[model samples]
Target: MISACGRDNVGSKNTAQASHSSADAATRTIQTVKGKVQIPAHPKRILTDYYAGELLSVGGHVIGAAPLEFTNPFLKDKLKGAVDVGDPINVEKALALKPDLIVTDSDKNYDQLCKIAPTLYIPYGTAHNIDETVHLFSRIVGQTKPGERLLAEYREKAAAGRKALKGVVAPGATAGLYEITDKGDLWVFGPNWGRGGQAIYNALKFKLPPKLAASNKQYLQLSLEALPQYAADYMFLTSYDPEHKGTALKNLRQSPVWKDLPAVKEHRVFYNDFNTFYPYDPISITKQIDLFVDMLKQNAKENKPGQGQGR
Candidate 1:
């Protein structure tokens, strides 16, 4: 009996060793924005400190995320059980989750997250366009095929939007977007920002005036008095604080400078929800395109003689 027990114990030890070897062999080294990391063949539990939308777009199995509330509303219902790891990321909570891989923005806590798990640093605004950002994240998580499909779908939607808007928007027409903060500061969004700039200026092929076209910055602070100089044939206005009761919009509508602008006189200024238009990811861009096309069609019917004719 003693000899038989010893042989059984030896066999169990060899089996354990073989299982560990298999696990080690399943991992492969992949280069990240920060450096190379050995990740599992399929990362089942992923912790994305930022760009949760982009990760989900490529079908990443995200277990935890940061800035959880900022995820696009369309995907919010899908992330019902995702843990909120805090904006800068709560390392202790992240460690408790025991994720197979962690993806974070290039924030100050990059090194700290690396200590907790196999982390990859992908900074926000690093990619120039949504497709580039999606592709990069997909490659990191070994979902390149899904990423390509997502990109193709996005392109199809954009092309359809352009076709729909062509008949509604007049030739040589321009569009502008601005947001008023709760503190009453005015800001403008460009092609790089999350405020529908990519969909409006790039995908939909809208024109930007010479003054607003001079810079490549994502956002620019503006004064209310100078609103006329940057006015376009159509304008989108929304408040930074969604629950503010439209105080800023009210003030702008009452102002002589704002009332005199062509878009305002023509009733071409459209109001949008802060949450819907704030994210510039693939999902959000798709929604923004839909909203833009719908609004343009409605506004075109309201266009009157001598409306949107001013400089």
Candidate 2:
């Protein structure tokens, strides 16, 4: 009887040891843009200085964020309860949140955030390809399957957008995308910039004018004098400041150079809202594709081929 009791006790001890070992293996060491970070098996309270849109797209939990007014406008309502840590992020406020993990693209506040928690700094423009951003976010949160599913969904939507605009826009048709600041600065974007370039140039395969196509920079700041050189068959124009009340657009319309542009003369310019069309994340991309297809259809109906000077 004594021997049997000793055997039972040994079996229980081994089982408990095995369980503890499994739990330890669950936690992993991951390599981030900044360096290596050991994260919990499941992080509940996550703080993101930026890339909130990308996190939300993949269904990651974001308990805290900074610059909420700017990056998360599309899903602001959903993040109503999230703690706004301030633009540049307040270290005191962030620590008070007691986050499990903190993610950011800026290194300015990296040391401060690291002291508060296990912070991961993802370099700026690392995810210019959108798919890379989604995959990276998924791997960080241990949601690889969901990330793949979300990417598939985005691909399907992009394909559908191309099909929808097939009859509306002819092959080889060129387009120019530009944004004007309240201070009267003109900005043009390239294929990887946030201004619907992925959807316009990559997905829909629109051509850029020769002058604008020369450089590979995400965006170029140009003067009013140079605007005529970037003219194309169609134009997508927007203003950054919502309260500026069309002052920039008004000024551009007054310019003789702008009026003489082929897109303007043919009335093929589509004025877009900054908030809806500027972001390059999964959510914004979906909306941009739909809006772009509709705009092309409308332009095709109103203006036929050879109606514009360039055509």
Off by over 4 Å in 2: 1-24, 68-73, 242-245, 304-311
The prediction achieving the highest TM-score against the true structure is: 2
> Model 2: per-residue lDDT, tens digit, 1-311?
11111112121110001111243676545555444465655667888876677777777788878764355457687567788888677888888998887777677777777777777667667766767777767766766676778678778878998888887788899988899998789998876777788778877889987787887567889899998888778889878875767787788878898887877777788888787777777666656777788878877776765563221
RMSD (CA, Å), each prediction: 10.1, 10.5
TM-score of 2: 0.84
Give the backbone clash total of model 1.
0
Write down the worst ten-residue block by lDDT for model 2: 11-20
TM-scores, one per candidate: 0.84, 0.84
Residue range 138-215, candidate 1, lDDT tens digits: 765666787788788878888998889777887778888888887788888887787788888878889875578876
Candidate lDDT values, in order? 0.72, 0.72
